[model samples]
Target chain A: MVRLITHNLLACHAKGCTQNNFPLQFKDVSIELKEQEVNSEFVKNFLPRLEWKALVNTARQLGDTSLPEELPDMVDDDFLKALHHVLFEIHVEEGAMVCPNCGHSYPISNGIPNMLLSEHEIG
Target chain B: MFETPLTNIDYDKVYEPAEDSFLLLDCFEQEYQSIQQRFTGRVPVVTEIGTGSGIVTCFIKQNILPHSIFFATDINPTSCSTAAETIKLNDTHETHPFTFTAMQMNLTSAVRSNKIDLLVFNPPYVPAENVPEIPKDLDDSSWLDLALLGGQDGMMTTWEVLNNLENILTPEIGIAYILFCARNKPDQVAETMKARGWKVDVVIHRKAGWEVLSILLFQK
Candidate 1:
């Protein structure tokens, strides 16, 4: 349930949320990387939609220190492999994703995160 | 692939037949061969929207060339997991280069905008007399309500898929291969695709059967 694609759209849906709150930072997250064969075409196709800084930072927090600070001009096999690992392999089996601005916590259990907010939190 | 009529055999009998009866029929082997022929060349990235038992997926992986990447998805997580397990069972060597990711995703939310090359769907197209009783197995999830029912005319799910195809499919290079029933208004589907400016083709047509599975290719 915590796919990076879904993670990109999720924000702190709490009341009175404003300004740079989202792309919530992961807190004390546990990750497992199941390496899949790198598809350079897919990686190249999906690069535009990726949030470079957020992804790199999240990967770093999850103990993957392979990506560069900035995306390189020529994306080689090595870069794509790392990108693949960052995107698909790492599964967030446990932990909470906290919104830096609003201070909302989305908890993860059994690799599935409960994103539904309480009645009071609903806008 | 050979054409077979759904009415030729009793639905209930074939659905839950005896072990000895299945041995004589060899339905699995025939289905496997049909699936293999579909993915033999140019190894397209295939995404199955309603991969029920994962039989088709396993068949494709086993017989097709090694380069194809299969993403088997279902609205039901349990169904997705079952498919994933089947994939693991069939996959002997990791070096075969097949990656099967079973994900719980709805049609509206799951797929990225204008990204998929091919979409395979075999939705529930049997139109009901009244809103049929929601089966106990599907009561746990809300998706089954819309996913299985084809609306008043039994083409509701088919229409939904067509509407979605307009957005998810690129006019220049996308194609959606779907299967529907003969009693479920195939003309409406063809008309919808034509109205949406897609070149439609009837790849497979079965005679004297209620379940008429046609692969509609939507191209620019």
Candidate 2:
């Protein structure tokens, strides 16, 4: 159940892999889409906190071709729908999120990710 | 001396006012799902101490529907009233049956003897140099004394909440999720929760700028 925003901050917490450890790549993924009522005002307000490029790229990887190549000047209904889908609708049910830098894998089982690292992985 | 009108100071403007916190509201979904997975279909009555804007409450109403009764409280009467109004406005056209009670109560005075199903709180856990002055109406009441500030170390309110848990919480209840700012003494909070005979787990953690936020789920 890693939200894109949560996924954004998650990097390989493995020792000494701090540099370039972000934008973790998702693998063997399963997602569930639950359509929540579109709240455009909320989407408009959330734009500032999002990693736009990362979100666009990740949504592409997940086969969601809803967002535009660049964030639009105005948040129209189309844009808000896309933003809502990418942010709230899609859920990572099961997958292994691997850190690009440290190559550490956090496994997701039954929609929950096991983020605990072994003794050696803990700094 | 000139007095400032409370309405002139926009409460919503004080917050970052972005829906990102609403997106971060999704973090509660993960927490909710995890609880459901662990508990398996038993939904408890939930009470959120500081139900800021009702974002998380709305999430609960939408995602974990049918099993939970939600009661949200805040020190700020305006915030509580606004949250209640928002919930009412959103649920008007929908068929989602939810009982949301919004009350203006301070955390310390808010706790009751009844055992709650789930206790959720996002307290003022930020460490600040000076505690912000309370408004004229809330001057005598410590409830609105900066809902985000936890004293010099940012754990004063948290400690107070924990101390009062014995009176408010019951052993029959399964879980309580307390989201605290990472910059504060989280370990101390964890240690305190542990000392109180509850199993503490760090379910979700996010870092925003210099401050980090963690969702800690405490189970009896």
Q: For every candidate, how close is chain A to the native chain A in TM-score?
A: 0.88, 0.90
Instruction: List native contact recovery per candidate, as a fraction of 1.
Output: 0.02, 0.00
Report the lDDT tens digits of candidate 1 across residue range B1-220. 3221111222221111222122212332443454455534434555666555454556545554245546665655445555666666666666533445555444433334555555666665668654333333543543354345666677766677787786665445556767666667777778877987888876555542334444455565
User: How far out, in Å, is residue B62 in model 2?
Assistant: 1.4
Q: Give TM-scores of the second chain, every candidate.
A: 0.68, 0.78
Candidate 2 off by > 4 Å: A1-123, B1-24, B37-43, B108-111, B129-133, B137-145
Summarize candidate 1's per-residue lDDT along A1-123 as a digit string, tens digits: 355544543456566665666677787777775666677766666577567887787777768899999988888888988887777677776788887887787776555454545557754
Q: Per-residue lDDT for B1-220 in model 2, tens only? A: 1111111123542232223344335566656556577545443556777665665665566565434446676656556655665565556455322345554445524223444556777777778775564454532444444666767777776767677676565565546777777666677878877887878888777776667777777776
After the best TM-score superposition of candidate 2, give how far the Cα of residue A117 lies from its true spot, in angstroms. 47
> How well does each candidate superpose onto the true structure, as a TM-score?
0.65, 0.54
- State each model's CA lDDT, in order: 0.57, 0.62
In angstroms, give how far residue B166 of model 1 lies from its true place. 2.2
Evaluate model 2: give its lDDT: 0.62
Task: Give the lDDT of residue A101 in candidate 2.
Answer: 77
